[model samples]
Target: MIKHIVFWRLNDTAYGNNKQTNADILKEKILAMQPKIDGLIKIEAGFDFSGEKDSCDVVLYSEFTNKDALHRYQIHPDHLEIKKWLAEVR
Candidate 1:
């Protein structure tokens, strides 16, 4: 299996939302992708509550069946969609 993880530190304000709100939105959006993607064994995300300057606002973790599965996920339309949004906000 392949395990993938990501951490994001969002801008104070992005997409007309504050960092905390965006972090919650980002977690929900990422976690919602699990059932839609093939070969995705597991997926999860969480928002940071510590409010530390050095901490990332959100974290995403996913598991895939194989390397190919991971690669496919990286390019999958659903994944690509969120990636695009992250680029603008993170």
Candidate 2:
């Protein structure tokens, strides 16, 4: 299996939404991919509650059956849309 992890430290405000709200939206969009995309073994997203100064606002963990599956997931249209939104939000 292949493990893919991503961390994001969002700006205080972007695209008119606060960091927390944007994180929430991002989490929802990411989680929605599991059912649509094939070969995704597992996926999760969460906010940092560690109380660390350098903590990221959001983290995404994903497991894929293989590198090819991971590559396919990366280019998935839904994911692309989320990526665009995240880029603007951050």
TM-scores across all candidates?
0.92, 0.94
Q: Once superposed on the true structure, which residue ranges of model 2 sit more than 4 Å away at CA?
A: none
Tens digits of lDDT, candidate 1, 4-85: 9998889889899998888888878888888887899999998888888899888898999999889888888988989899
Clashes of 1: 0
Q: Top TM-score: which candidate number?
A: 2
* lDDT per residue as tens, model 2, 7-69: 998988998888888888899999999998889999999999886888998999999999999
Measured with C-alpha atoms, the lDDT of residue 26 in candidate 1 is 84
Which prediction has the highest lDDT against the true structure? 2
| Decoy 1 TM-score against native | 0.92
Question: How high is the lDDT of residue 57 in model 1?
Answer: 81
Q: Supply candidate 1's per-residue lDDT for 60.
A: 91
| Clash numbers, per candidate | 0, 0
Model 1 bad stretches (over 4 Å)? none
Shift in Å, residue 55, candidate 2: 1.0
